[model samples]
Target: MKSFITGASGYLGQRLAIKLAENGEKVHALIRNPKAVKTLEHPNIKFFFGDVLDNISIKTAMEGCETVFHVAALARVWTKNSDDFYKINVGGTSNVIRISQELNVSKFILTSSTGTIGPSLNLPNNEETPRWSSFNNDYEISKSLADTELLKHAANGFPGLIVMPSRIFGPGIASPSSGVNRIIIGFIKKGFAVIPKQSGVIGNYGFIEDIINGHILARDKGAIGEKYILGGENKTLGELFEAIKNRVNKNGLVLKIPVWPLSYYSLFSQFLADRFGIEPRITPDLVKRLGQNSAFDCSKAISQLGYRITPFEETIETTIRFLSQSEDR
Candidate 1:
């Protein structure tokens, strides 16, 4: 069957498209960047230059495609243009869902983020987790709203399923989520960091291949209108630093910073951003988010879609290797 994917130029979409093509499926990759056309070379893959923001482009690329993976979104924590997040994440999703329903595609998978799940301090979040009052940044807020839109539409007979992935890591395409690799490298290169270890802020992580597998499984077996979280290991910043230190052969230090200090720093960072158009390296939203526990349970995905999560240690090695090689190039 032919598949159409939005954000095919992105890390997840790129990996998904390549996998589909290698499996001998016809894949149409909707890309906003024209230069990406040459990079996505594959026998079974076709590049369609289009933006999800454009209704005509969506209709054109999705025509005759049996499966649609809406993977594109404004992924950064902050951008100079904030409204683009709503326009692309929410508006774009709405258009895709409408077109998919109109075309009656066999499956429509809306890629959502686990960022919508929680700032839960003690309890681990799951698919049943309630909406969060706090967000990491604009990206999370827009994505949360977009996810809501998908669920609302699904309740009204939209043939769509939401696949929420948590802290996905692996090789291929230096996309937005690949920032985790930089964080890893920094820990390896520099000695360590100062953070509030006691703060409940943490996350569940999964490798790219396993995440791709999760999406495929969800498409094949997921119940319509359901949201499935594709996640694996839950880890805190201190734990993550230790893992990196071990992987890179180092015994580093993790200095614990108070939450109030970080919040104060974020305020100064935001000031620079607003006055000089400089994107803040730290934001109050990010500090607040990083202070919350992001542990999640993917039992529903595991039981329903037969999802298998690769251990986080294994993924760290894979990611380090990829980043190292890319830097060498």
Candidate 2:
């Protein structure tokens, strides 16, 4: 398949593109930075440098593509600029749907988030979970809105499938820069006497390879206009950190702290961000998510798309090895 992917330089998108290229498929990736685009080294991989806001750029990149993977989005829990989230997530998604329809592409896969199912503390959320009015952050709100829009069009005969992956982590080529990787590395490397222990929330973090494979299955078997969540092992923050610590063969304290402090830090960080252009490392939204059950039932993906996920311990070990090697480079 001649595939066209947006956000091809991102953590998931880059891995998806490389997998396709390695399999001898022609791939065209839309990346805003020419420098990042240069990293896709496969002979079958090509790139276009432009923002999703520019229809001309998307059109140019998507031309002659049989399958369209609309992976681009402004993925941030906290941001100095919130408007970009709406623009990139909602507006950019609209452009991709419009162009894919114009071209009559066979498959248009949308990479959404399990956050669209909204937050839960007891039961695991699923694709059919009703959305709560309260969202985790601007990014969640924007994606939920965009996913709604795409499904609305699907109801009106839009041929698109939405795939939501929860908390991806694995040996990404950009492992050092990936969010989950940072958390794993920081927890081990920092050697803190104790780490924040969050028992309230359950997170379903999947391996990157399984997520990529899930995408292919979704492309082949997913029902039109339906959403499938490719999630992995569900565990609390404390369990997650414990798994990492054990994988690293180290013993550290898992400290349980109140969310109030994280909330306060978010406000302070936002102040610095607003005045000095410093990005907030912690935000109220992030804390809220961390304190909620970000867990999901991927049975839909598993049963419908035949998806399988790697174990958490195995993924952590791979991440550690990749990060250790990256330090040399």
Candidate 3:
């Protein structure tokens, strides 16, 4: 099988391409940066330098491929131009879906965030959950729009599946998206970190390998126009950090920071970002999001797609081992 993948250089996309190539599939990976070509060097993989906005680029990269994995999107919390989120996430997704239909691609899989489902209230949010509130940032809003775009195409008989992953972490590319892995490493290496004091705020953490496999399962067994959440255990921030600390045998000092002060800090960070063009470590929108409960239920994916999640402790140990070896080198 010949598969075309956008955002092939990203944390998930890069590993997905490698896995497919290892499985004897011809992988056509679209990459915007020429330098990223080195990262995707595989016998069965070919790289194309292109942007998602350019139809010619996408067409050239996607030609003669039976399956399409549209993973490209603007996922940052804040950007100088907020319009960029809509352009890349929503507009780019529309372009890919249209082109996939034109080329008669058998499967079009989209990687969306579970944030589009909104925060959990009385129960953990699932694919069918109705969003009760407005989005906190442009990234969430744009991704929701992208999900809507895919649903429209799928409703019209286009073959498309959406996978929403939650707080993905594992040994893979050290991109911004790998927040869980980074936190583990930080706790192990630094022995100290500041965490929010919101003990009730929960988030579903998904292992990268499980989520990647879930993507493949969605392609093979998922129903048309259906959305599947690829997630693992749901735990609060404190519990998550405690797991990492306990696994690493590190007596880390976790300062439970008040939300109000963190909000003020992020506000100042945003001001600096707006004025001096310095990238803020955290933004106000991110602070607001972290304060909410983002837990999810993946039983739909488990029952329908035969999805399975690794034990939380096992995944953390494996991730810590990988990071330890990397640190030594």
Best by lDDT: 3
Task: At residue 12, give the lDDT of candidate 1.
Answer: 92
lDDT of 3 by residue, 108-185 (tens): 999999989989987899999999988899999999999999998899999998999999998887788878887877
Candidate 1 residue spans exceeding 4 A from truth: 188-194, 197-201, 249-255
lDDT of 1 at 318: 84
Worst 10 residues of 1 by lDDT: 193-202
- Please report how far candidate 1 places residue 8 from its true position, in Å: 0.5
Model 1's alpha-carbon lDDT is 0.83
Q: Which candidate tops TM-score?
A: 3
lDDT comparison, 2 vs 3, better candidate = 3
Model 3, residue 204: C-alpha shift (Å): 0.2
Superposed Cα RMSD, model 2: 2.0
**Alpha carbon lDDT at 48, candidate 3:** 91
Candidate 3: worst-modelled 10 consecutive residues by lDDT: 243-252
lDDT of 1 by residue, 265-311 (tens): 88999989888999897888877777667788899999999999888
Query: Pairing residues by index, what is the TM-score of model 1?
Result: 0.93
* TM-score, predicted candidate 2 vs. hidden true structure: 0.94
